[model samples]
Target: MRDKETRLKRRMEPALTPWSGTTEATDWSLPEDLLQQASRRLSILCVVAAVLWGIGLFIGNSFPPRFAGLNGHPYPWPGNLVGGLAITAAVAMWLYIRLGHARPATLDVGLAFLVVNAFAIGLLDEWAPREVRNRSVSWIAVVILTCAMIAPSTPRKTLFAALVAASMDPIGALIAHLRGVAVPAAAETFIQYWPNYAAAFLAVVPSQVLQRLGRQISRVRDAGSYQLVQRLGGGGMGEVWRAEHRLLARPAAVKIVRPEVLGAASESDVRLITQRFMREAQATAVLGSPHTINVYDFGVTKEGAFYYVMELLVGRDLVSLVRVFCPLPANRAVYLLRQACHSLAEAHSRNLVHRDIKPANIYVCRMGLDYDFIKVLDFGLVKFGDRASTRQNLMTADHVTSGTPAYMAPEIILGNVETDPRADVYALGCVAYWMLTGQLVFQAETPMKMFVEHLHGTPVPPSQRTELPIPRDLEAVVMRCLEKDPQKRPDAAELFQMSCQCKASVPWDHEAAREWWALHLSEFTRGLTLAMPAAPAVSSSPVTR
Candidate 1:
């Protein structure tokens, strides 16, 4: 029977593709958010350039020429025309971004605008009176340096853009000579243009530095056999990343705990945090229940960052489910809670107590032909027999509590050292309350106040808080689990049996789950694409106050 179950589990796992190193190069591509930021910066630069040009035009007309030249120089019509055109172009580019047309090709458009700005500066220089032209550092240098600083791109792309922009100085000089303007000697022109060209050449340094830094960060994100894709979310402890197996191409989620989070902690606290992390990975990996989140691998990176890879879930947690859809029907709540109970039951039978069991920790996802499948997650606070108190003390030493205050059991609040499986049972009951009413069991202004309510206040029944009709039997089971006294609460196994007995008006079944998902999650359902493996299948938030 065990072997048959293992075979079934393997078949249910996500498919993986053959290993390839080709995808690693794709990681260097700038994300859309970063590109958007670059576009905004470029737009701002254009506006600043336009304003500077307007100011220059105002000063030129209002004051006498501040250079050694004849007082009479035919209104400098060429300079005025070039300056006006530069201002117009800068304003147009700014408007282009402000009007919300800066996407799909934002980087390309920004680069083109940057090159135009550089060329305009060079033209303005060439059109200035001969006495003033090439007398000081070129404005083209400033533009090149600023563009390099603001916009990030590939080193090759940056080099090409900078070189093209720099060449505009010589090109402008050529245009001047062709237009009957007597240009300076070649040696003097080179002396004047050298700074602009040098600036352009040096601009690539920042791009190279940024790219090298990005590569280093990518390396740090790389775990044993998986590569971190993007961050899903983060909390006080660490971040969770969407990752994929490097070789097999199987999608997964990686949770990372960097060493810096413990930098301010004392040695003992650091040791406790490390032990807790290891315990979380070790405990979850050994659990045989399919309802529990599967751990595929865990290790420390070369930089001392700890990470663990687990199967990626494609659906929302109960918290989001309630937030989006409001209170769940009693039947559906029971369906999800039963699956969570199964996971808890397995952990409890093995002398493990999941100290944190809130709605956020209970995920409901699609599993092959099955819908509304629940997977229990976040076992970082799991308590083994006899060591529960010591671990709790270390966790609370910094004045921060262990389990979430909203779903914390009375025993945990009272600082009981030997909390049993009933603690998780109480927390699960709180989760049921949330699913039924879309509200916490107790409403308090602060975490401490919430803790006080859990300790001394009576919880309003779930049925009273919401318009949704919760079944009497299920309500009784939830209230039984919420009993302040541990002895009055049913254990995980008993709670599972009790949950199974509750008969809803319309019992949740496979067909009902499928129908519900199709109605509400059609987009996600339609987008699901399972990757096929070329090789044998390998078995795999919460606020801290």
Candidate 2:
């Protein structure tokens, strides 16, 4: 048995192995799917344009110049050339899309499309009277705008195409005049088309630049001491990544507020978010519960994005566990909730109320020989008490609703200013119900309805909601936590004791957790070994508090 456990630990140790020394962010393109989708859409548009041009050519050939209404200056050479070029360009685009060559080919095809169209329009402009030359430039400008709208080109490509297309008429007119054709002077042609050129650039540049910047930021790997390995998840405010520390060689998870979120916000809003981020990091770092996530490091990046590092966990959160194997056994639910209570009890004693306590924020990790170890996460929404400061109170005083609606307590939903540890107690009750019943205490379609139910509706007992036999003692404890009034709901310390008192057959203790993980999560434990040629000496940098 001793040898077996030793071999098990060896296999799992690779999962804890950290990647050494940080590297700078490398340039990478958008994913293949996005590039291919944009390319295919542009190629299809080219095919449609080619077919339309062929039909127009057939109609022109079936009649005389005067009867065809070509302004009595029918030039089949220019029309045939432009139409044939469109068809050839379509074929090239089709090949580009089929072969999946997106980068260089996209620019090449865009340039060809712009130059050929401009040259064709310039040739036809030679047939128009001098007074109509400026009018013809307007029509040609419209063509360029329409093509840009259909192409899958980036801002850089669009800008290049716009500049090349803008210059073509002036250059084409000069060449035509040199060949003895009656055309406007190069300077005059450019002056007339300048407005159109400016308009084309204005229409596409801003949106494209914003899009390109957003994509580039999302793919960034290096952010200070931690190097991002893979994106874990993201929300409206920020994103979380599985990362590793450089010198310490410790596996960690990093959460970062998207840089653009602050860059695009008003100054006051930016200040609020930054303050909130720092407060959260400090608050979480001060928490001393073994059930709370260990904060490793925290700081602002060089690019002005706020980020913090936490110990990376191997097991899934309660949300995932309930989703995959719910209708959890009664004792198992009690075991997990008791650990969560211990975390919240510590936070409450420190005058911090964790506004968000949903199942998703409560992770069940395999900590060494201990299985079913709960680690409460995301203290970013921790609300300080009135004793802190008027400024601190004003920050969250707007009564910004700050928790999952499904798990929110009545006081939070009612916008009460004095929300306390009781609010967390209510949320914990909702989590317990979800674990034992696989459904929320109250089911509603919209978030508003869920909030309304929390504010006014009574919660159904877990035993009545599901077929699973929830023990009477545990059921009583869950019901007590779900009480609407803050005065009635039990505090975390009391709930922790009550959960311990519940006499139910526990099936998710340390032994069961190890056995279950050996059967179901062995692969997750045996992680890939990240190469670290020369592991650096661990630094003694102090953690933020």
Best by TM-score: 2
lDDT of 2 by residue, 1-545 (tens): 45643543353332222212112111113345555555666677667767766776787566654444334242475667766776777677667766766653564476567666666665655544454344644545766676665553556666777777766667656756766667666677788779668756863654375456535444343355777766666765677777767677677777777545554334455556765666666678777799998876666543445677788776777777788776788978988999999999998887788888888788876776677888898887788755554345444526577778999998888876767788999999999999999899998999999988988898888899888889999999999999998899899999999998998865557787677767866644443455321111111111111
- Give per-model TM-scores: 0.61, 0.63
Worst ten in a row by lDDT for model 2: 536-545
Predict model 2's lDDT versus the native.
Answer: 0.68
Tens-place lDDT digits, model 1, residues 22-45? 222232344345556777887888
| After superposition, candidate 1 runs with Cα above 4 Å error | 1-221, 261-263, 266-268, 387-400, 531-545
Question: Where does candidate 1 have its weakest 10-residue lDDT segment?
Answer: 15-24
TM-score of 2: 0.63
